[model samples]
Target: MNKSEILNTIHELLKNIAPEMDPTLLGQEENIREALNIDSYDALQFIVALCEKLKIDIPEQDYGKTATIKSLLTYLEKKII
Candidate 1:
């Protein structure tokens, strides 16, 4: 998948965890968990959703690499392509 597709997938997964979240207002450098005010469990749920939906593996150690919108997109782009 491409970056746009990856971003859309991220938005979809994020909505599942925080329905109130507005993807448009999310900054590329913003922290997703903090933006959505979600807890660790919710964060993991989002990550798991991304992994399952994208059919990619994001090990626990690399979770930090996905801390922001840009980072996650960058990370996903690399993995997806």
Candidate 2:
């Protein structure tokens, strides 16, 4: 998938996980959990959702790379490519 596709998928996944969150309001450089008021469980669910939808594996040790939207985009872009 392309960058835009990956980002849209991420936004969709986040919206499914937290319906109240406005994905557009999430800062690329800010922590998603804090920015969206999502708890740890939701964060983990987000990761799992991405993994399932994108058909990619996100090892626990690499979860930190997804802390922000920019970081997650970078990670997914590399992985998807």
Candidate topping lDDT: 2
Prediction 1 global C-alpha lDDT: 0.86
Worst 10 residues of 1 by lDDT: 16-25
Clashing pairs for model 2 are none
RMSD to native, candidate 1:
0.8
RMSD of each: 0.8, 0.8
Give a tens-digit lDDT track for model 1, residues 41-77: 9989888888888888999999999899999888888
Task: For each candidate, give its TM-score against the true structure.
Answer: 0.95, 0.95
- The total of clashing pairs for model 2 equals 0
